[model samples]
Target: MTTELDLGSIRHAPKVLLHDHLDGGLRPDTVLELAERAGYRELPADEPVALADWFRTAAHSGSLERYLQPFAHTVAVMQTAEALHRVAYECVRDLAADAVVYAEVRFAPELHLAAGLTLPQVVEAVLAGFAAGQQDAAAAGTPIVVRTLVTAMRHAARSLDIAELAIDYRDRGVCGFDIAGAEAGHPPTRHLDAFEHIREYNGHSTIHAGEAFGLPSIHEALAFCGADRLGHGVRIVDDITEAADGGQRLGRLAALVRDNRVPLELCPSSNVQTGAVPSFAEHPFDLLARLRFRVTVNTDNRLMSDTSMSREMLRLVETFGYGWADLQRFTINAMKSAFYPFDQRLALIDDVIKPRYAVLIGG
Candidate 1:
């Protein structure tokens, strides 16, 4: 079991990230460098600091337009094999610095075809980048491990192709399949064929459902497609009903989630910005957590959200007045839900996370 945190010594904490997006986490400096290299100048700001502020402001619009602008720039730079590898490598380097023990990052290789790179080439470049990033992070004494999730654009019709690519690279570092993009009209069932392939092949998957949409989308992702984990699952609250007293009413769907222990990758700030939760106090984070849902906090789109794991944790601490115990509970939830091998996951818990936390809480 994990213990309370001292906050003074958070560097040794074994953090885990499950809902990060590769195209959404570029460093401002790197964004500029890649933008210049790609000969694309859609950025509103020429400097790194201004560029970051610009991204934060755009993302704050809480509209699809704000969410889609930065990606246009990121995807533009990532068209080439070299640029893709470089961005992937730098992402891991940044995560390691943040003391991330394990991270599962996803990107859609199908979108990089504008520069004429094959799907396999895109996957290969990202793998090489992860390998290099791990080595570089280790040398810097901030060791981290990263796994890949190959995503298919939901509005587009490349799910089958991307699913095949993900399976091809599974042993090479790719962990699973995912469907991303605007979820309002393009439901997860639209890519059921690809989901069926992964299901038939025994490949694990987590879908981006119930984020921009509601419980109907999440229902299809799990019931119709058999999602291993839900990306946000924030809207599952639609099925929950609180009573006048301290007791609560568990709707059938909410009961299924609780009984099965599906992980809700809850990013409080991002969810609010995305209109999933409306506001922090009204957010279902405390509600879901108190109901014993397998809830974990995350930074879904760090660049757009202008967030990190530490920042998210600090926000929860501020909002709910959470102590070390709550933070550990959230961290354990993340560890249990990570897409890593069981033995390595246990080893991390026993060796790294448990020890540092024990020292913090004086166990």
Candidate 2:
């Protein structure tokens, strides 16, 4: 093991998470309180520790319903505008605590329909929550910037409607659009109209591809429907070949990913829990990193996977023998792939991430 990984001062690290799910990251305390207030009795237990363990076990079951159980509890409580706002606020606070300087959290506004809030209302409330959360973090001296990505569920047939909602709110706070949920049969091409509309209206898109599926799913997401970034694209390693000695050839698809700089939001622990990767030791992260795959690390769902940005980084450091420089590359890759205009993205690189790493390296 390359034993130079020290994350003791983790809050000082510049972190970026792009694939976190809003519904999948509810605080256990929030869930218990929300369930009590909402008079919903579906919690596995009222205690936070037990509740968190229940979420991890249930979500890690490798079954569709088990994986989606937490959403029901989270969505049921998110009926009122206030609940939505509180959840959004806490999400940002949690990210800030994890030292995430920039994060793009995505959620399907359509799922928040139980409270009778319109799509735009849901978007607005979440943005208000993010602003509130950032303000609170600033007051606490841990400033962080968070943006929302409006996601449309693939199982639902309202991609076009969601696309319009995202476009309408783009200037407000919706940074990009995504399609997620049960990627087995639902390919990104299913939402071509949504993608095309997003493309026409000057919107950005990142598809949940190559997670529960394989290269064909990724190919379809990128080739058929132009996914600018990929969520959980760990399977692209399938297309790469290891030759005699140290030579390698990225099958056409992996080459496309590398050449185009399509970022892979690789959630190491979550990938193992979800069975996307066999194990952390065998995870393709270091391989992808060494090969320059525009790879970025993330906590796909903090509540479900029981992970923080620090924990994810620590797991990779201890497993992959990653040092500060390796992690610095991951952060830089995420900044490059963030859904922002060139100038703002450059500012994140020049101001936030680079300066922090320089201070760490004494460069």
Candidate 3:
């Protein structure tokens, strides 16, 4: 008989993460040290544990605007090359330890420019750090492939520049381009030039839509901006309804999303913290999953949520009674949706994910 899956067993299974943010997952102690090194002392708490508590508590305010307030501290401390490098390195170390076999961590290059570093400089620093972290993780027997997704702030005008930057570094550790920030006023179509540029170059992009906004945001992201995926697409549920027969019915937009196999990067805990969903039970994740939407689990902000891949998966198992097979399906879904090259993604799925999951499922 299959053993009951818990946090320990979940961590042992290989996972793929596609929607994590680089600046949103800093270690508390790292934040403190970076702040001290940079001489930016605006932290709410001095102690590491207290600082961690502050971030978690602060992010639980149930407003997307309030949920984003804690990023100021993390961004303040991650200005210099050394600080960015250290945080990137530690991010890989932490994710590897959590048994995430592959991850695409994104950050806005424009946010790191306050330290006078150029966009390329910031991207280079993060890519170099990821490379070093991969080497270290491989040497330590917990091998992981960490790639970068260069993000442009949705409220900013430099999206085209960031898109070009992502394309320039595509052969490097950078895998794709993304746009993140508040989603209410700054619609994805506002960055039409950038999305067009990425498309012209045959590049990949994921837009932060359907999180803080409704169907229009998701519709524009898919139809106008041509996002390859939707980040925090919990609001896609808005376009779905229960029919009189008690079966879930998909609206026109939802039908298109499902028909196209568009992946929804759902972060359960972060969704609750941001008030995207009333709670985990109310989250559209299980509904989307049951309806066969290409739903993948993610920890949008590990630090803010006090979560890891194992913790996210374990929560699903606890709340939805997801077994090993379900977890494996999510992992494979993420792998399939990754912006990485097709050959590499296939190799990881065939050689790594499937075999490991087969063993875990006792096949």
Candidate 4:
């Protein structure tokens, strides 16, 4: 409530995160320790600080494929149930420390099967970790609610299986299903059965489109797959044009997206690291926000981008001069778009987000 709008001040403001990756947000020290305990010796750097630096540097290669290369080590160590639980617990603790009141963390269960853990075991382990973390955070007076999004690798054919697994644990802690990985060749259309299954069961889903791919991918996700949200839908900018009089124009697909209020889970720093945009200044987040798209800020990968919800909001505040009101709007947008039940989402917004922002904005 100081009107300073710095990192410390922003961290005190209640925030909602919609697109954090579980495996991608591990603590450097935890990764080193896990690797040592698991006898995994493929680490590029043995030291925690150096390993963290390596991830940031390597992710800056500006190619989506190259940016994803660092996940090999993270996923390698997370093969065991203990490793997965520890990582999940630490993810919630870190986000709670950053003042993220609600977050939907995603990870591919198929990736964690390397150590002979079944899909249900992987989901349960992460969910158990989240529950324990939430209890600890509440006891520490910085409460947070962390939900899981079961992800299917786009290149793999297990999307249907993953979708079922998500639905099976929907009542527990898993909130939704997702399809991720390189978006170029593996179109969301390829997983039509998985999306259709979720829809048949009345489940929620978000597709990883418009990041490394283009309009066709998005078109398929919405028109065909019926995605509830767009994961990194920054490339929707391509469908927006400028008129001769310096006005903005929205194409049919863009109009469809905007008119329907489809949420765009935008991760500014991760977008730049993955070469989705040249830099933060050129990101379409501001444009989409101004256009009234249901835009919500996120941290796609905390370890790779070294970002948190506060850092993401601070970037927008510094670049676009967003005030407390703006940040609150983004936070509310995320809460509304969350896969949580309507009543729970409304309760959090009314009781937590709005009240906290009122204090900051009024001060």
TM-score of each: 0.95, 0.96, 0.99, 0.99
- Scored against the true structure, residue 343 in model 2 reaches a CA lDDT of 94
Off by over 4 Å in 4: none
Please give the RMSD to the true structure for each candidate, in Å. Answer: 2.1, 2.1, 0.9, 0.9
Clashing pairs in 4: none
Residue pairs with clashing backbones, model 2: none
Candidate 3 on 155-176: residue-level lDDT in tens?
A: 8899999999989999998888
lDDT of model number 4: 0.94
lDDT of 4 at 205: 99
lDDT of 2 by residue, 146-178 (tens): 888889999889999999987888887888889
Candidate-wise lDDT, in order: 0.85, 0.86, 0.93, 0.94
- Give, for candidate 3, the lowest lDDT window spanning 10 residues: 1-10
User: Across residues 1-363, which tens digit of lDDT does each residue of candidate 4 receive?
Assistant: 346788988999999999999989999999999999999999999898899999999999888999999999999999988998899989989999999999999999999988899999999899999999999999999999999899999999999999999899999999999999999999999999999999999999999999999999999999999999999989999999998899899999999999999999999999999999999999999899999999999999999998888999999999998999889999999999999999999999999999988889887
Tens-place lDDT per residue, model 1, 1-363, is: 334443534545668889898999999899899889888878789999998888887777675435666678778889998998999999999889888888999999998989899999999999999999999999988888899999998989989999988788889999989998888889999898999999888898999888888889889988999998998888899998878896888888889888999888787877877666668788889889988999998888888888888888877877888866677778878888887789988888788777766665664
Better of 1 and 3 by lDDT: 3
lDDT of 3 at 117: 99
Q: Is candidate 1 or candidate 3 better by TM-score?
A: 3
Question: Which ranking of candidates, highest lDDT first?
Answer: 4, 3, 2, 1
- What local lDDT score does residue 217 receive in model 2, on the 0 to 100 scale? 88
